[model samples]
Target: MRHAVTLLCLLVLAACARVPGPFEHDPSRDYYARPRTDKAEVAISPPRNMPPQMGQRVAATLAMELQSYGIVATVAPADAPIQVDGVMSTRDADLSIEVQVDWRVVGRPRTDEPATVKTRARPEDYAEQSERLISRMAQQAAPRVATLVGKPPNFIPRAPGQVAAGITIPYEFPSDPAADGTAAAAAAAAATGTTPTTAPVPTKPAEQQIKVLVAPVTGAPSDGNRQLYSGMRRALGSSKIVIVDGAGEDVFTVVGAVNLTPIDDRTGKLVVKWVLKDPAGKIVGDIEQSNPVPLAAARGSWAGFGDIVASAASEGVLELLEKAINRPR
Candidate 1:
């Protein structure tokens, strides 16, 4: 009788847990089933509740996997062809964690159903399993994505210096340094039928403003970091940028990773890599800025480090502004 009672309890516990399964689909919505143009790029958002570094690793891994199939991909910030977002949930069972990631294409009527992974709750296990699952998904999805956004549209050949409107060549960053800066200039000039003499000079450019949320700096001395954070806020505010609590339409987020390496007893080099992402989780721009600082000043005991961060913030904001100008509409 006792054995029977224990079995009943175990059954009840198992019933209480929510088992993982494939994503649900609405049959009426066949948007994803329909053929479409190939996306030029893909941006993957990190899974929630994971360490930032780990999440980035997953995205980067997925990006590489997609690239192998001839698709351009990155962890979010710059405007891209598609966006990927995901969530992770835990259940009472030891191996009941579930993760799902969805792919969204701009102007598309339907989003691709999410690919998911279910595994034991161990953090390390989750990471490894999720990586494999994501890699597999990327490989499976790439051929379809490539086919959809298949070919560059046909256009009449023009003179060497001639420009054409409504025509674009999909470009990815960090591939060619010179081309990276030219994508925007080329877009702006495409409307005017004139070859850009230099990187685009915005004529009558609108006051470019975006709402931004700045995440706390990592790997910096706390006391000095607070001062630097405040100084950065002030500098960005003066540039006519509005700081926001969350992402929304016309909103962006700024995140950073900082490393302070001591060069001597008192002086050190602070390396800051800042990334800016638009509301869709597209990377807009990034800046890797470094400055020398005195240890005392870096700990907020002196103002020297604050000044340096303030200047760096201004420059970072300027880069975002340029990205905004060049970003696809």
Candidate 2:
């Protein structure tokens, strides 16, 4: 009876066992996605109230030291979102040169406390020891500056089939007096039954065109300012908008500002803001383009790349112009 019971128990266990085939996965969970740990980027402006060469060295050293803490830092202008500005001063007393640097972070809702670093060197050794002092100051200020920034927000790709509505501006061609004179001569010939030397000019109603003057771009590195300026003109030329050389009573002005922030040694974030103004200098609207680009591309010549950027941004620019045109003056 005990053997019979044992056999029955074994049969019951076998029946309860699950057959293994393939492991089931939840479709809702991403199996291949990794956690994002991207850190914020910081910009270090050249130190003020100091010699130009020394200021440059200090800024460069500070950037390098900040990178040691896993922070991507670059020497850039004041337009960057997280900027570190330093005012340096030197004092000579008792045959010794004392160097002091006050570092401040500029940002919204600023929470970082300003840091100051000071070092002294003998008058004879000031030149040779300046570098060491600068490096030391950088090391001390980097940690405090690092606390001022955090992980940057993730970038989301735009959806497909996204496009702005087309805007039309009213344009009238300038009257041509020479063409008018030719027409008069032709008409006289026709009436007097004599052949005219020049052919008659055909007259038609003035067609629509919008004249826009693209101002030189600001805050771009290398030759990017000029490249973007010409590129914007080229992009606008394709539409009904006429690119003008200068601002006039009938012309609209487009001003651009480019801010490049290094995200890493290899990559950077470029933000281009285009502001449109009417002939009277009244603000129309602004369009912005932000994207991640290679650091080399951002810092180096924009050359062929500027055209691509302008083309991508032209649509929004045109849309803004359209809105301004439709708006009641």
lDDT of each: 0.47, 0.59
Best by TM-score: 2
RMSD list, candidates in order: 26.3, 25.7
Q: Which 10 residues in a row give candidate 2 its minimum summed lDDT?
A: 159-168
Clashing pairs in 2: 171-209
Worst-scoring 10-residue span by lDDT in model 1: 1-10
* TM-score per model over all chains: 0.34, 0.38
TM-score of 2: 0.38
Instruction: Return the top candidate by lDDT.
Output: 2
* Per-model tally of clashing residue pairs: 12, 1
